[model samples]
Target chain A: MEELIQQLKEQIIEVLNLEDVTPADIDNDAPLFGEGLGLDSIDALELIVMMEKEYGIKLKNPAEGKEIFKSINVMAQYVNEHRTK
Target chain B: MTHLGKIVITPRGVELNSQVYPTSQIGDALLTACYRSCHADYPKFFKMDPLCRLGFIASELLLQSQDEERFIPREDRAVVLASCNGCLHTDRHYASTIHAGDNYFPSPAVFVYTLPNIVTGEIAIRNKYLGESSMYIVEDGLTEEELVQRLAELTFQDPVTTSAIIGWVDYHDGDHYNAILYLIQK
Candidate 1:
């Protein structure tokens, strides 16, 4: 889980073009949107694409994104369980 | 309309109201250097394409010359930008992404900036501007003075707009990009 979370952080930073951010900057449980990382709607879409491209986890429902992308910890846990690749 | 201030950015250097920023480094680093010179804190600036970067930096410097904060929200202001190339640079980048093969993922970040007018949108979002704004791909070989006149006419056409950051923001590559913005107010 720790390894996956760190990997997710790096991937998110690269995918979102968050140039100044590092894996250490993002807290494991901090919110990815609104208050924590301040990611907007476009960023959310990019994250979705990143998940599919990297993890082979096709998010069938759009609503599931909110739960899956809550944070690096939640995202890593979800991907670990559901990712086919 | 009355001219409040003006900013000129080019490969040579950046000039705001005759105050020249030293040409420390040119090309890709120039825009970042300009942003850093202002000591401004807008993280989204890094994500913008070169065209948007030129416009954003020009507008920021233009506003600063008038002793105004670039991020202040206002409804009476507008942005009228004209570009010669009109995002061909980014179009080439977006095209590279959709190539049919094992790699066919088009980046939404780069896709959002495919239009020339997206610069206005980015500027609007940054400043919370709820006023008239537009982007034009100018066909005429107008001189700098002529462009100022053309932009002034566009801004004046929108009666609701009391002021505007109007100019040409052209960027094709690291070697070729220029933005000259004038803050004009009624």
Candidate 2:
């Protein structure tokens, strides 16, 4: 679980091009959108694509992302269970 | 028949308002070096594709010394830009993502910049200009006569358009780009 979370942090930073942000700066339980990461709609779409590319997890519905991508911890948990590759 | 400002950026270096900028500190990546030389603080610039970045930087240099309120109204200024390659480099990069059979992964970040007109949108958004904005993909770079003809047509077509930012910005492969922008007033 800890390893997955750390990996998620690194992937997020790379995909989003968060040039100045470090993996340690992202709190596991903090929100990934709105106030926490200040990410916009485009960033959300990027995250969705990242999910499919990195993990073999295909989110059938965009609505499912709202729950799964709420935080780093949530995303890590979801990927661990659903990833086929 | 008035000229406000002019800027020309090439792989060699940058020329702002007819004077060549010193290239002592500028290294291989001329675009990034020029952006840093301008001392622009806009973070969104980092996320833009090379074509958009070139257009944005050219527009910024042209409008930097002018008073927007007194000279050109936000709603009356038009952005008329032309490009040759028209985001071909970004398209190639995005295509690479889905090329492999087992590693098929399309990137949304790169896909968003596939359109040629997005560079015009970036300029409009940055300057808060609500006026006309258009991009033309020409086979070769537009000649001065062709650019003037287009500008004349735009000015005549839109009664509200009294000022325009006209230029040619082209980016190909990697590290090969050129942008020449002119601010003209009727």
Candidate 3:
């Protein structure tokens, strides 16, 4: 779980091109949107694509993103459970 | 058109009303470095394309003085941006993302900035400007006076326009980005 969380942080940073942020900078429990990372709607869409491209987790409903991308930990768990590649 | 303030940004650095702000990061880091030097707090700058980033930084620097005026949701304020390349770099990159049939992954973050006028939108969003906003793609030899003239025509044509932000912001390549912005008032 810890490894997955850390890997998720790195992947998010790389995919989102958060140039100033590092894996260590992102808290496991911090929200990925609105507060914490303060990402916007576009970032949510990017994350949706990242989930499908990187983990094979195709999100058909855009509303589910709020919960799935709530935090690094949540995303890590989701990826671990759903990733096909 | 009464010019309120002018800001020029190049790979060399920035010049606001003839005041120089030199930067050490000349090539890829010029825009980010300029953004930092201006103490701009907008984090979305990191997500913007080269064209939008160049224009966003210039607008921030150009209107930094009008701190109070910029924050207010002014309906009479306008933004006009000109570029030679006009988001060409981003369009090429975005095109590449979807070009392949097998590996097509066109992200909205990248695709949203595939237009030159998005710079005008970014400036409007940041400054809460509800007035006229537009962009123009011109030849390489478009003069500074001519850029201002284009904006002046709009300012006069619109009855509600009391102030405007105008500039030529272009990013042709990593080493050839430039933004010349002006804040104008009647």
Candidate 4:
């Protein structure tokens, strides 16, 4: 779980093009959007792709991501539980 | 016509020779490069608000070092942005994730950057420009006559339209972008 979270952090930085952020800088339980990471709607979409590519979870309705992506804790939990691979 | 001066920012570098910049990476490369060539230090004028792409470059050219006090509230400052794709680059990139996989839900982060006028908003925030602002996405390139007429109307009718930045920001691909800003005065 710890390794996966770390990988997710790295991926987020790369895909979102976060200029000054690094993987170690991201807190595992910190909010991924708004005040925590200062990410907007676009970063969320890129994260969606990261989920599919890294963990093999598919989300049919993009809207469903609201709750799932509330925080890295929620995303890691969801990925752990529903990952097909 | 409120012909001010033409400030062209292309991806390849400074376009002092009136050369057409290749239309690629219209989002970051073209916009940032244009702004960089016009200004010595790119960081001085760069704002990472995501919406600060085209208008940011054009406005940087017009304001130059006046950005510190640019928001002093001029009576005649208007923001006029015309782009073919608007913020579609961010939109399409976001959509690709949702469409690519079934469980991949759409992200709110990616969704907000889709608006065509976000660039205009960013410009307003950076410059504290409380004057008139607008965006137009035409099927083809905007007709010169139409653009000229609009400029005329803004300068004549609107009291807060002293200078304007009118141009096209079309990002059809990752490596293509084009912007031409005209800083007009009454």
Global lDDT of each model? 0.84, 0.81, 0.86, 0.64
- Model 2 lDDT, residue B99, Cα: 95
Docking class of 1: medium
So what's the TM-score on candidate 3?
0.93
Q: Kindly list the per-residue Cα lDDT of model 4 for residues A9-60, writing each as its tens digit.
A: 7777766766557887887777787776677675666677677767787777
- Of models 1 and 3, which has the larger DockQ? 3
Give the alpha carbon lDDT tens digit for every residue of A14-77 in model 1: 8887877899999988999988677888888788878888988877776789998998888998
TM-score of chain A of each: 0.94, 0.94, 0.92, 0.86
- Looking at model 2 chain A, report the run of 10 residues with the lowest lDDT sum: A34-43
Report the Cα lDDT for residue B45, model 2: 73
Residue B65, model 1, lDDT: 46
Query: Which pairs clash inside model 1?
Result: none
Better of 1 and 4 by DockQ: 1
Best by TM-score: 3
Model 3 residue runs over 4 Å out of place are none
lDDT string for model 2 (B34-105, tens) is: 667677777667778889888888887778787555334378888888888999989999999989988877
* Tens-digit lDDT track of model 2 for A1-85: 9998999999988888775579999999999987766777778888888888788778878788889989999999899899876
Q: What is the lDDT of residue B97 in candidate 2?
A: 90
- Candidate 4 lDDT over B109-165, as tens digits, reads 556567778777667666776777778786654575576566557545775466665
Model 4 chain B: ten consecutive residues of lowest lDDT: B42-51
Residue-pair clashes per prediction, in order, are: 0, 0, 0, 27
Score every model by TM-score: 0.92, 0.88, 0.93, 0.65
* Local accuracy of candidate 3 as per-residue lDDT tens digits, B48-128: 888888888888888888877678898999997778899999999999999999888898899999988999999999999
TM-score of chain B of each: 0.93, 0.89, 0.94, 0.71
